[model samples]
Target chain A: MSETPTPDGSPSTWSEDRLHRWLAEQSWPATLAGSRGHDAAVLETFAGRPVLCTDQCIEGVHFELGAGGRAAGRKAVLRTLSDLAATAAVPFAVTLGVMAPRSIEGVPLEAWLRAAITGAHDAATEHGAELVAGDLAMVEGPIALAVTALGHTSSGTVPVGRDRAQPGQLVLLSGPVGGSLPSDRHLEPLPRIEAGVAIAAAGATAMMDVSDGLAWDLYRLARASGVTVRLETERIQPHPDAEDAAASSGRTPLDHGLHDGEDHELIATIAAEDWAAFRREGAASGWHVIGTVEAMDRSAGHLQLRSPEGHSAWLPGAGRGWDYGGGE
Target chain B: MSETPTPDGSPSTWSEDRLHRWLAEQSWPATLAGSRGHDAAVLETFAGRPVLCTDQCIEGVHFELGAGGRAAGRKAVLRTLSDLAATAAVPFAVTLGVMAPRSIEGVPLEAWLRAAITGAHDAATEHGAELVAGDLAMVEGPIALAVTALGHTSSGTVPVGRDRAQPGQLVLLSGPVGGSLPSDRHLEPLPRIEAGVAIAAAGATAMMDVSDGLAWDLYRLARASGVTVRLETERIQPHPDAEDAAASSGRTPLDHGLHDGEDHELIATIAAEDWAAFRREGAASGWHVIGTVEAMDRSAGHLQLRSPEGHSAWLPGAGRGWDYGGGE
Candidate 1:
């Protein structure tokens, strides 16, 4: 049989044997015990700091390859970093589990992969993180990238989960809400580390990144806090881009603004009286308040939103939540 | 437009989104999160402690759907846990990364997935490990599984690597040598953890698992240690299964034993004086001595072998290695 072309396009000798030989020649980065030849590699922590988070971004659902490799890489970092941000964690390192197509042969694949890695590096450096271990394999269809980010949080900055929200607290959002849609916004949502850390530092009772839309995420905050939430829909700030898209599409700007997810902004709550001080602290670091928490029947996990027209748009389905099938 | 039909021939709402939602509802067995969603996990030491290793086995490369889900699941876990055996690392915990096709709607797919997890659990438990975290996703094509295993070894046991061999150490092979063709053996090669751990504890100088075949893997051991290695062809041991296949196919048994990769057995070396002790220790563990480690010129990465008929078998291109795209 004729030999298949290699990545370099010469008569390839990458038979199973040749692949082993090639792997043997690579000088692995650090003090890994046996380099890449062993079944599993053992990595040493340089500073006794360990960070780990795994994120899965699917194809068609996450992005199309035509969207450009850099954005895909950036999104990959953001998805993991957002999780880190939710916990007030700082990025330190990352490992990638990339599933690329087997048929997309040659330099293009390598080049694309390099671009993705470069994007990750850029974002990692911005967050003070670095890429460490990586696993690459070729599969049959659309590309998928799974990243595990390692980070460190300063002592005592524990996870400020929604459970910490107290009754009669004021709920706030960072910056404008809802714009990511029909394009790279969903593909490259920003990780709100600065806002999250600031909010935590300012003594916010509870926090979470707004992954789903505002209505749905507020429900999460309500369910976690065992109280009902009251929102002034008229005060619900909208991103200018989202406003333009809704007006042009003949859809309610409120609908698009409140339901259009992928806004990686922080949604936090503080004691009602603490709002001014929190706002002052947040303003110096960049933040905006949107609503407040109230006393509703603890048994009723409901969220109340008053529309601009003095009507209630309290959507029970508003916070459908990012339901992973079967509900783990 | 009509929705896609399920495997059961019903209209399906089994969209990727819906499947993700469904998966999220399934309660997972509680698992210890050593790193609990961090960037990397840490362990105190490696001396005599078990290390776990697992890799995802997707449908196309590892098996086909027609191959039967029961066997496929078993094969997936076996492939991963076998690596632990090679390192003499006792098996402990494993996490699953599954990508299921959305078209295979209904309980059948769920059954297949659960079966695979059950198979993994059984094999792991049999080998002294437990199944831990599992992640599931619905995609557009062939199913893929990523199994990550965690293991710990007993105190005082050292991790035997390819680079730790000393000159004059007798090389040994455990059980069968090769013949895990692209068939059943490939799907079900036995892992040699017991033998590996036993040999290490008995003072085997260096060792490695033979997944890529005797000749190619030995070359790796030699290159890593910066030493030259020469093999005795006649001393090569063949698995009985390979010997039987060779007899019927009119191919030399030696070729199958030395070249065909996927024999997940231990290939180790013990210092000459420790040879008796090694054999005695490995006797209860079931290993066979194969050759010797020698001090020779570095550039002569030659493997010498004498045929059963007292003729040379190391002729150019006579012995084969795995075709890892010809990098060997």
Candidate 2:
């Protein structure tokens, strides 16, 4: 087999030194300090509270070569950004861990890496964050990108955590879900930073971004908060692509909305009284009241779906969504 | 063609859900908040300054299966900790990204994962940090582990960084270098956290961990600080195993000291006047004066060594060490 070509069209393998040189050439956030060649990147925090999270996007698992290296890079950083949004935190810096393949679809390894870094840089810039530090390795298999995003909340604001949802609260969905896969919405869903911050400021009791299917994530919220959640099936709006996805997958649009993964919409629980003020905040997307939080009952299940007919049943596929290691 | 077996001796793929469940059972740092099932682990920072770094250890690249999964895991975390030490930052939390192979030797996959996690956890604990978050995926190639370490500096102490070395500074090494491979010192070199902090406090201007070979890394420091470095060959001290490494490889112990990578020793530059004070501070193992910084002369090379006979020449193998992609 022929050797892989570097981005410079040379036969030399992509070295750590080359990677560092490329990173140094990029413009980082003003908050970043210290030289680029140091062992670590240092950042000064304005808000004392540091919000940190890590996420990985792997080939054949999170994305495929067909998705393009740019999308892969965007999704890797975006996934972690969504987590920061869940906590109502403002991102400041990110450190990337990239394991690159020898070649990507006959393209030079360097070209693929450049595309990936550009994608990450663009996404981070758009979200008010910067690529501060990163590590690169050459792997014999598919590419894997891991991102750790460091963020902070405003001085007096505490992060909205998943275990604080209270009973007698209104459940809100930032936007439509389901059928995200068919529309490729999973590749580039906007992280709900604005909506999350508004909702949190409006007294959101608890919140989380919906990554794995709506039902599965809701179940998680319920378990964490020691409460049960009831979703009104008819009130749940499917994405515009749900119809097409349902047609191809032999499932209803509502089913796709409930089970499809990577929606990246924010799901939050707020006091019933705060709902009006939250709505008046004028979040980019109008909120949808899809459910309510109730006292937990072990025998009744932690999560249920209420049909328009007033009948309720435990959500189907209680904890199923996309499984990286295959079987649900 | 058969399915890989988990460390638990079960014929199961390493699922994200399973990994989460496993993580939930472990004890995290007290500062860690939010539910275990959340998208990211949230940390409350005691120090306002955040230090971040990322490092990856890949099978066949950083280590082989013959070295054992535990050693691989330890080395991955150790590498990042070394970076933290170089900066004189105290590590608070770390997130792990692991891509497991279909099979590891004849051992079950689950067993291998268990060993790796145990190793990482032990290492983190030894350094007063915790594994707060992690991601795991299955790959068709060798296992890869990426670790992002988050740290902090005390209230008024600034992190030691590169690019501060002055032209008239003394270069110091915390310990010997070379021959880390056969002796397996690379797998478990003690990160000089205390030493680094003391050195930084005592007025070291520039510092870095020697992961790459001494000559190669010194060249990096020279380039970054905009000065040339001169090493006194007679003063260079090789590790105890360097002689054996030289015997087996048909090279001189000094060659191994200057070229073999994975030393993980701290190298620093201090003002000539501070050298006496630095020595008075009683740094562990004391410091070795290996070289001095001088005005940069592009034509004369960035790094050179002065022999005992009063002869000086540029170091051999300019930028040669361990190459991840292939041949050095």
Residue-wise lDDT of candidate 1 within A107-143, one digit each (tens)? 2554466567567657766776655444455676667
What C-alpha RMSD separates each model from the true structure?
Answer: 5.7, 3.1
On residues B1-328, what C-alpha lDDT tens digit does candidate 2 reach at each position?
1566655566545555566666666665456655565666666656647889999888887888777778888888988999988987888888788888655556666656767877887788899888777777778877888899988765566556787788989999988889998788888978788878777777787899988788878887887888889888878899888988988898889989988888889999988777887677666364689999999977657787778666444543433545454432
C-alpha local distance difference test of each model: 0.62, 0.78
Q: Indicate the TM-score of model 2.
A: 0.92
Best by DockQ: 2
DockQ of candidate 2 is 0.53
lDDT by residue (tens digit), candidate 2, A1-328 = 1566655675534555666677666666456656665888877755646777888788887888778879989999998899988888888888888887755555566656767877887888899998878888878787888888888775566557778888899898988888887788788978788887778788887889998888888877887788989888898999878888988888889988888888889999998878887667666375679999999976657787888667454543433555565433
Q: What is the interface RMSD of each candidate, in Å?
A: 5.9, 3.2
Error of 1 at A305 (Å): 4.0
